[model samples]
Target: MLTVGLLGALVEARRSLELSKPKTQVQWVDLAAPHGPVDLALRLLGDETPAPPSIDPGLVATWDHIPDHGAVDRMLQQALVNAYGFVVGYTDAMHQVCRWIQVLAHPMTQTTNVRALLVGPTGVGKDLVARTVARLGRRASQPFVAINCATLPRELIVAELFGAEAGAYTGLARRRPGLFQAAADGVLFLDEVSELPLELQPVLLRVLDEHAFRPLGSTTQIAFHAQIISATNRELASLIEGGAMRADLYYRLAHVVVPLPSLAERADDLDLLVRYLWRQVDDSDPPEDIIAEVARRAWPGNIRQLRGVIERAVLLRKTVGSTSSLLDEIKAAPAAQPVPSGTLSELRQRFERDVLVSIVQRCGGNIRDIARELGITQRSVYNLLKRHRIAPGK
Candidate 1:
């Protein structure tokens, strides 16, 4: 019995040691630099090696301690990447959306008389910002109703916005609340507001002014007090000039016009957004050159194009294990094989002159640095500058 007791004690001691011993030395690679949340996680896990005894293991007791580990971070990152891509991805998806909150609180946007309009190119996150603001507004608990003016038939536009009474129209069998009535004291986001037909504009204007609309076949009016946010990609000024949009409705809805900038305008934010998205996909550090290549491309579709490019790159990266060749292939593709009318000598002269001028300007008149950057002798750069009729700085 004593021998068995001793054996049991030994087994217990072994189990405790196994439980206490560091399982596997977790080396979290810092994808971002120092002070980055991901880097903080890496530091807590120790510096790419087994954690020292002096380090506190309790620091990472919860996954929330690691910024990249949270589910919200993953979901938000993916959504931002898929929805807006890099560059304007985070800024457009989050920062611009958040601005609506501040705008809602501002005196100009808070007044009952003032309406807000969000204007930008399609897929530039105009509607997304409106929906996000509505979700975060004080009336979050109330219903949020959204109507796409462009999608509604002209005949039903009034009924959709102001409800219909029983037997009011051919198909109206029961009383139904319109979006505006259903969203009372909440929010009504009208997308593509410019598409609202010219004939129905007066009714919309009346609703904006009186905050009340009578259902079809009903003499009594129903009151609706909902915040109205409108969005459009079309140029309202042009539309008004063309007599497509009501000037009065435009004035009322554009009390606070927020123009969202394109992704190309905020290219510097691409790297940060790329890292954020990579982490979301549970990917380690992506090659720096791949990110640089993405930054160089001109995304005409703006954030939407960037996301498609990234999705392709990620898929290629997974299958090929290298993005350099993919980048090279993209670069090597013949650039529209130019019209084929110019002489080689003429093109050469034009190219040389342009390059020399650019290098000189970039050097800020320092010929030495210009020569180094261009990988040529200082005298050669000076000669090219002279040939191009450019004066060198003393």
Candidate 2:
């Protein structure tokens, strides 16, 4: 009876524990029975862990909206591309210019008085050659000031050459510097040196002699430290003989005279120069036939004329979209055709007669264009017609 009572107490305790505990689901099968018995149990668990948040759409959109390059950036990139495509050709004159530049850049040459003069026909790239030399020299960083003496009148030439102090003249309110002083420690390119007034020649001579000058109305003398490069289309020797240029100044300026070949002389460079300018247009290589045609032409105006023709051709190509036949068109142009064969003297006389007739015809028997074109001070267009014995509108 005591054993039965102990068993009943144990069964009661197990029933109470099961009622207090949380239930968990579990599945089980009884091994002893043929039919399986399955049981399910459930137990309490902690809250679920959170996942990472997604990125904001606006931030992603903002990054995608930014451009890889801006307008100005694109322009600069194109310019660089065009510049790299620019082909500078090798010629005897070009080689000379390069040699001069190399000599100028030499350590010993910079401190010496090395003056150079460029003599060539109009539009033959004399100024360009001088500037190129300056660009490649040791003084590349220095200022390069170019002055055309022929463009300035005689009265103002002095002030332009040497600076004036404030109140030096009626127009002088503020103290100003001249080209020589302005080009201090740099280069001063004097174009049309033969056109400089005879009176002002002394001032230039003094500068070359003393390397010093006084501005207008200033008692103090200022020292000028600069290289001088002068260019002229006129024959310096003839100008000196004609009393237009001082003989002493001519000698001083002509220490090294670089005679630039005309465009006709370097017809080979025409195509190269044309292609260069073409590439500059839109960074696109022109058709080979166009370049060949350009090379075939005898550019009368030299580089300048070549540039103009190429520019027109480029514009036409852009509009018409056909460059294959450009050569024939260029060859057919009036200027491209060669003049009839003649001796040098015969050619000059014929050209002169033709020019005189054209002038007379255009002026209605007046000579204004011929006079102005020839840069003569006294002769009028009518006077030229009278001298040439040509009738107008005949």
What RMSD, rounded to one decimal, does every model reach?
Answer: 18.2, 31.8
Model 2 Cα lDDT, one tens digit per residue, 116-160: 888877887767666655564567688888988889867767777
lDDT of each: 0.61, 0.60
Write one digit per residue (lDDT tens) for candidate 1, span 53-120.
65556532432343443343344344333322322233433355444444563434434535679887
The TM-score obtained by model 2 is 0.62
* Residue 163's lDDT in candidate 2: 84
**Runs in model 2 with CA error above 4 Å?**
1-88, 319-329, 332-394
Per TM-score, the best of the predicted structures is 2
TM-score of each model, in listed order: 0.57, 0.62
